[model samples]
Target: MTKSDPNRILRRLPLAVGGLGAVLLLINRLLTPELTESQARGDVVGVILSAVLILTGLIWQQVQPRSPDIVELIGEEGFVLAQDLPEAVKTELAWASHLLLTNTVTRSLIVYYQGKILLRRGILAAKAEVTPGPILKRVLETQKPIYLVALYVYPGRIEFDYLPENTQGVVCQPIGNQGVLILGANAPRSYTKQDEKWIAGIADKLAVTLQE
Candidate 1:
């Protein structure tokens, strides 16, 4: 489920209230409350307003959900690679990075291998160096990927200052036990389940390539 799932459910609040009002109004009509002519007019007005509320709730439910607002990142399009990498490994990294940037929602990518920056491509930050903080370190030790579907809510995002600033989402995919593939997206919660699986497969392939 997405981070906004709960918020979306909360939108039903208006419908719930409207439903309750309808029920109460139905019962009132059945009981046939004694009232003057003016009171009956007011009652009619209340019923009309209740119907409007129900209609509004139905329209709200049908409305499409909008993507989360994320500030655009400040950076330049660039590519960087570790000079010590073998030609084969360099070629593999370049191919993977290019595919991810062009095919996926990824706007910035970084491959940190064996304690060094192996590749940096797509929109790049000013600083070339990367320091793994709690989040990246945890992912490496656990050997499990961490998907920050929405980064603005997480304070740990600060550690990825080397990535394009204000990156909306991040995925830390571990390569074997020594490397982490960081993918930064332009919009929050844009990556789907299929995208995650594809990224994991890419990481597995990179781990083997780097080892060779």
Candidate 2:
């Protein structure tokens, strides 16, 4: 799932809750006319208050800045990792690569093991040996993902050495000790925190699968 999915759900939640409350209130007013004026007013007020609180909560949730949670975004089925390195595994990797490309502004995806390219998709300059530069090495050492919102904004960024021409942003994640996964895009700030979390989850799954 992309970032927009949750936002869409959140946007509709208030409407749904409010609609339900309104329907219940209308039914109560029509069917229970025998109730005292005070009781009817109390019921209407309770329904209105409930709907207002729910709408307010929805608005607050949308206003709050939240980093996309990977599990919440994709759930367990989306995190399925192949158990062995086979044709199926390659297919699965390609599927994941394509999924990321479709969801984000990614133009190129590369997976490298040691000094050799294992899988590559989209536009990229070919090289015999993919060298791990200083920044990449640091990511591998720390086993953390790195996001460069704008390649040009960082002078002498190591990613520029290996990334394709005109690549503007990148999100690189270390796939255990097996290799590294790099995603390249042409626009600055194309990848969000949610993308990082999603890719990290993928990297973790890939690491576990490769180790097994």
Candidate 3:
């Protein structure tokens, strides 16, 4: 018996796709012999097929999604979680606002001090009063973004009664040990590595800002 290497599959994908594309080209050429110039144009079928095949080949190699560098920056820092302030939390909230303004986040809610939820963009459909302090507490405790799949978890915490019918996703980030930045979208796509980096950068900076 012979042992097979798994990596060989990835290396052979391009060749396999190319071969399949060649067979397709041959079949196409045979079926439409008079359209040689059209086929040669390389703009209609061949080029598209080639590009698709190449991408397919790459996908088979266990291509992982790119994670941004910011994740490491904020994932393990244990600071600013044991204090309360009036002005510091406000600054952090402002910074979180900046983060939401620059991204495609469709909905957001910031909870300050005790549990005061500040509506940034869309409304929250949660049950609680949607305060900023509690949310920030969660972020400080978990250091992870909370992905709200729907509006049933904390209906009072959300103010979704005002948004249009195009709501999608939501994300909340705690920054400056005082402010909570909330983001929402109308589509189902969650945060990406780049998004996380931007959030972490803002959060870390906000933390410093709150300290000062």
Candidate 4:
């Protein structure tokens, strides 16, 4: 979509309202009341009509798609993680427990580290997948994040130790670049460009922490 000049719209709104007011005044005078008491109805109609025109003019001026702000979204999601996982992982099982709880995306999230699903968090109760190692390894190689919305992962979504039902959204980021940050939503295509940007920001933060 083409970008809009916000400054131009801001300038036009007042002019549009002034024009609407003039038109409403003309109508109120031209359509005189039959009875003196009915003049109240004209006043009411004028107010309602003026309100509708002003609203219509304002909406017509500011209808455009804007770019998603990624950094802001990252800041919001990162807060969720920092609050959930403040401590370092001691045991692999404990690490898995942390992953499941910290990750709000899927009903469960499995983290594959060092050729194993090191953590599992969420509702699914199944044995680790048969091919998690290869799947995660491939995801690690891609160096980009994957978003899964509405419980369905992409055609080649990395295999997890267990499949999660109602897995609305999935984001797979390579640990090397940034630990994968998956944010889930129930509706399909719920992940917008803004979400990707936010996830990327979170991944970048994780990368810095990992490097340090």
Which numbered prediction scores highest in lDDT against the true structure? 1
The residue-level lDDT of candidate 1 at 146 comes to 98
> What is the C-alpha lDDT profile of model 4 across 1-212, one tens digit per residue?
23457577665675587577768677766786554667767666766767776776677666654543221111111111222332554233344335434443333444443444434444543454435344445566777665544334355533542444334455566656423433333345545576566556554644454455
* Alpha-carbon lDDT, every model: 0.87, 0.69, 0.52, 0.49
Runs in model 1 lying further than 4 Å from the true structure: 1-65, 68-71
Better of 1 and 2 by lDDT: 1
Kindly report the root-mean-square deviation of model 4 from the true structure over all alpha carbons: 10.3
Give all TM-scores, in the order shown.
Answer: 0.69, 0.57, 0.41, 0.46
Clashes of each: 0, 0, 29, 11
Show model 3 residue runs off by greater than 4 Å. 1-99, 107-129, 132-137, 149-167
Compared with the true structure, what per-residue lDDT tens digits does model 3 show for residues 1-212? 12355577766688588667867777877787477665578636675787677777766565545422221111111112223446665656655665555574444343433244443333434332443344435765776666554433555334433223234555666655455555555445556667767766776675565556
Ten-residue segment with the worst summed lDDT in candidate 1? 1-10
What is the TM-score of candidate 2?
0.57
lDDT of 1 by residue, 14-105 (tens): 77777888788778777885767876786687788778878878877877667666566779989888898789988999999988887778
* lDDT at position 128, candidate 1: 89
